[model samples]
Each structure stands twice: as C-alpha cells, then as structure tokens.
Target: MGDDTLIDQVRRRYLEVNGDHPMSEADDVYVREHFVEATPEAMALMLEGRLPLPSYLLSDGTPMVPAEHGRLAEIAGGVDRLHDWFVAFWPDDPATAEEEWGHYLSGQYVCLTEVSPVRIRMKTRRVAEASVAVEILRRDPHDPIGRGMLGQAVDGVLAVPGLESFLLPMTAYDRLRFGGPTVRETWVEAPRREFLTPVAPVWPLRTERLLLRPFRPGDEPALTEAWADEDYTSLLLSGTMNPAEVAEMVRRRSEPGDGTFIGLVAEHDGEVVGDSVLILQGTGLSEGEIGWTVMPRHAGRGYATEAARAVLRLAFEHYGLRRVVANLDARNDRSAALCERLGMRREVHRRGDFWSKGTWTDSYEYALLREEWLAQQP
Candidate 1:
C-alpha cells in the first residue's frame, strides 16, 4: 500500500476499534478528492503519538478514543509521566507562554500524545492564584451558579502551594477536553494615569430655581420626613431608614474618591425641602445616574425636577460625562415628564425591568448626551 493508503488503513482501524465501520474504496476516493495536505510537522507529530488524528473523526460527540480509560494500558507509567511531560514542556517562565509554542499549548492547538486504550485529554490550569471572580462575575456578576464555580476553582488552586501568589485569576479552558485545568497566566495591563485621579463630587449645582449641594448633617430632619412619605418611599426609597441610617447615607455621599459620592439638598429658604444624588456607578464609567426624592408637600412645586436638572448639569458640565442616564418606573408620568423637561430623551423601555409590590413593572430609561447638553446651554 502507498503511504496515503497506509494512513487511511490506520485511520480506519482506529475508528473501527471505537465502533465505526471501515471506509470502502468509494469512500476512500471521496476522501482523497477532498483531502487537504497536512503540514509535515503535524503528520510527524501524529505518527509519534504527540498529536491525535484529525478532529473530523470525533465530530460525532462520542469519545472516539477512550482517552482516560486507556491511560494505564498504553503507557506503563500512568498520569504522573503525563503530568511530568506537561510540566517539562510547559514553560517555567509564564512570559514564555505567550510565544508561538506557548500559544499552541495554551490554546490547545497541538494535541500531543494520544493516550492509547484511552483517548488523551488535555486541560490548562490557571497560573495565578488570585480570585478573579469579581472581574468575571462583574459582567454577569449576579449569576450565582457561575460565581460559585469560579469561587470553587480559585479556592482549589489556592489550596496548592506555589499557585497562591498570582496577581490575576486564571481560567480553565476546555475543561471537558482536558481532564485537569491547564495553568496559564492571566495578562492585565496597568491603568492609565488619568484613571487614578481623584474624582470630585457634584456640589453647588444650580438650576433655574434651585441650588443642589452635597448633603449636610443638618438635613437629617428633612430627609427623615422625605423618607416617610408614602409616595417617596414606594416609588423611590423602598427600604425603611432611621435617623442613624440616613446619617450613614449622608456620610457615604461626602466620602471622596475618583468615584465621588454626590448628595444634593434643595434649599429654597435655608431649609432642606428635597434630596437628590448623582453617584458614579462603580464600574469606572464616566456616566452616572440621577436619583432623587422630594417631600410630598413640595412635589407639585417641581422641586424634584429642579434638583434633577441641577445634578444633570453638574454631571455633564463639571464631570465631563459623555452621557447621563436615569432609570425610573414607566408608570411614573410625573418623573418621566421631568426627565423630558430637562432635555433627556427616552432611550429604552425595559419590559419587566423591576419587581415591586409583588409584580414586575416596566422601567423607562432617559439619557442626555453631553453634546445635547452643551448645545442647550445658554
């Protein structure tokens, strides 16, 4: 038989052991008609047991080769030798893993050493010991199952010595293909200098009729009353707060950081009548949301609208925000109208966005672009 015929026979026998029938002459003709040449190195690697046959044979989802089960029978040494081979082949320095050889192994591109009797399985371990659950979970942060698995994996790696001091958390790619996690370093770039600057809270923002400033200790009485209002509590502040709790809220607002907290106190006659805030969302975005509440007695007087507009101006003008958005209940026409008056356009109407009063309610999103605000500025 020619080299091509020999390889086809080997491939057919290999598949037959896994319960696939051998291909006939007609099948061989079809395969040859469409066969693409494998690189010399790839073919050599396959012959030397450093790589498995082409993945097309195993496309059916069943294990074409019993990788784990045949380990002992195929190799006299067992998993320790396999482990040693990986450790030897794995770069001692994590930086080297980024090179072509490293990339091949890291990416699982080179399927070296098929375990005869058992199909050889491969896995990449996370090189760093740090828990990256927060980073991964941030995008889908609320997924309890994903969080749990990530936590378990990190803790498992940390339990082993030498793996605990990594700067970033490592990910296990192709867990099913590989019996264990393959270790690879997670690469993270340093933040730019601008990201490290301290961000200031919005203060003394002025609308046509009101000045919105940071919260003060003296505004507790007004805040307590505002919190007690049924409409304010139901629509905005759903949680019950006592004097001390409200004081804590004020304290957090006054705390400084690039992520500054902003609390607004609407003053008409040297007395606090309304409260609003423009807090930076913790995700490092330049945009923020406006949250506010007005005393029931002052509701019709447009205190909330004035306070919100002041906060919006502070966000766009002073904070250099690209955009600012507000999420409010779709049914709250009063608040919705206030958003429109401030030149914020409705961007989205989320269906079943929130659960309240035992049922899901839609949410309305209002956003104002910096360009729009600048154009409107007189």
Candidate 2:
C-alpha cells in the first residue's frame, strides 16, 4: 500500500472484497457443467438473480450453480458491486465502465448496437426475471425512434435487474435492414430460458380457400350445420346437438377468454364451410388437440385439409405448443387420411375408448410435434 493511485485504490478495494472467494470446488464444477454453452448475457442473468433458467437449456434438465443461484454475496454482495467486480475482471477503460461493465456482466444495460448497423431503436420489457421482450425499429434521418434515444435507451432497465432472455420483434424496416428470409419477424434469443414462443398469429389466418378467425354470430349457420350434422358429429360430439346448446357453444367460442377451447371458423366467401377447434389439454399449452369439422357438402375438395393445416400452423407457429393431436373415429377413413396428409403420426389406436352416438367407438390418435412440423414446413 505504497502511495496508491485512484486506479490502484479501486482495484485493491475490489480484490479485498471479492478475491476471498476464489472459485471453490462447487463453483468449478458448476461452471464446467453449465458454461459449455453459456453466453455473456446468460452469465449476467445468473448474476442478476435469474437462475435455474429453463431445463431444456441445461445439458441436463437441471443445472448446477456456485451456490443457490444469485448467491452473489460471495462475489460482490449487491448487483452494483458485482458490476464493479465484473469490470475489474476485464482490464477495460474505467472511464467507460458503466456501459462496458453492464454488457460484460449481463447487468440491466445491454447494448445491441453490434446486432445491427442500420441504426435501429430497441424497446425492451423485462418479463419478470425470466425473459426480456424487445421491439426494434430502425431510425434514420426521417424515421421516428420507438422508445428513447439509441445506445443507452434501455429505459432505466439498467435501474431494474435480472433477465434470462430477450425477444426482438423487428419492424418491417428493421427486418429488411437486419433480418433475412430464415429469420422470422420476431427473433427471440433465450439461450438460458428453454421454451418456445410462437412467431406467428393465432387469429385471422389466411389460406388458399379459407379465412380462419374466431367464430362469429353470423358463422352460426356454418357451426350449426357442422355441429348438428349427425353424420359428422357422431364421431366427435356426445349425444344429439340441441339448437340451444349449439348456439351456446358458438357464443362461447365467438370470443376469447379463459375457456378451455377456441374455435376458428373457416370462412369461404361469406359462408362458413368448416370450423377447427384447439382444445388446451396440457398446462401452459404444452399439448393441444386439434379437431376439424367440414360440412359433408364441402367434403373431398381438400378444403378440410387446407383448413386443418391452418389450425396446425396456429398451434405450432403462434401458440408454440409442443405437441398437437387429432382424434378420428377408427372407422372414419376420410379423417384418418386427412391426418396423414398433414404429416401426423398414428400414435394411438384406442379400442373403444370413446363412447359416442350410443356406441363405444374406437378412436385413432394422430399426433405431430413441433420439430416434426418444422421439418415438414416449406
């Protein structure tokens, strides 16, 4: 301690506080096991307190941490102190410490300027400590920025703390400037948070021969025919369809709420030819059952196949469902054929598992997973 300069003083202080905890055996093992794919931001999120990221992210379903995750007291105690220590880890200019330290340590201030040179504006929203949602818009001489000025416009997100991943939904201008054909409109990079988020929309699906949307009152005529048709309903529905019950069902699906089911009416011209339903069978929409009913009058024209494809697109693209299943009466060759056309695997052939139309009916279950769906996509 001979005539310490200010730089030496800061360096000595950081070491005195944090140097005591040289990587323990537990810390070494944790880093060895989990840091194989770890990025700077992910490491920072852990520092900020978002640990136990998603299971799928880890080599195994579980991940090891230095201590109970966010046990940063061993390193620096508080996030701000941790930032100072992180800055010391890399011998960078202390004059630019705040921004550089934030990026290096995964603090609240993340810079994405390197992500694009088109001069894009970034809008970020931290979803709890799990993920951060960002909307990017390109700014030029004439364009108006979305949030704050470029560079440090994280909206004092730096003031808050802890986030696992980020979602960047690019504006059309930004997309053309930064995105390619492979990249969707919204690019989500959550290396630590292992989950799927749909890049598409669930409503107002446009297809070659159909426009799919949530059921409407006027679509009742289409739903009524499909719901009440004995020939079609016998395989899926229980008992006879009462007009009042059918109307209630249509009314319920006409709007979006917490209900277990959402039906999309396939509108052709102004008439409803068929309707598809997605029933939430698993928590967090991990699994969904897609059922479609095209009036017999419109059958065999591939309309049902096209419409069902739209439903599957919504399930996989918009809802980020892990798996979707279509149930068909074993005897219904046409429905089975439709499921086959959509690249679904015949996973289960339940013998008389479903009781329908006063009979114990054998059911065939056709299922598709997200990976398989992606392979099938053009």
TM-scores, each model vs. reference: 0.50, 0.47
Off by over 4 Å in 2: 1-202
lDDT per residue for candidate 2 within 53-128, as digits (tens), equals 3111222312222222344433566545555554453355575444543333322121221221111112233332
**What are the per-residue Cα lDDT tens digits for candidate 1 across 1-378?**
366654565455335423443344553343334333343444344445444443323232211221332234235464335433443343564443334233232223323232221111112332221235435444653333333334333333234322223322212222233444433232211111223123564356666777777776666777776665566666552666777887777776665544555666888767677888776542223567887777777778988877877777777766656678888888888888888988999999999977876668998999987789889889
- lDDT of candidate 1 at residue 376, scale 0 to 100: 83
Candidate 2, poorest ten consecutive residues by summed lDDT: 113-122
CA lDDT for candidate 1: 0.52
Whole-model Cα lDDT per candidate?
Answer: 0.52, 0.53
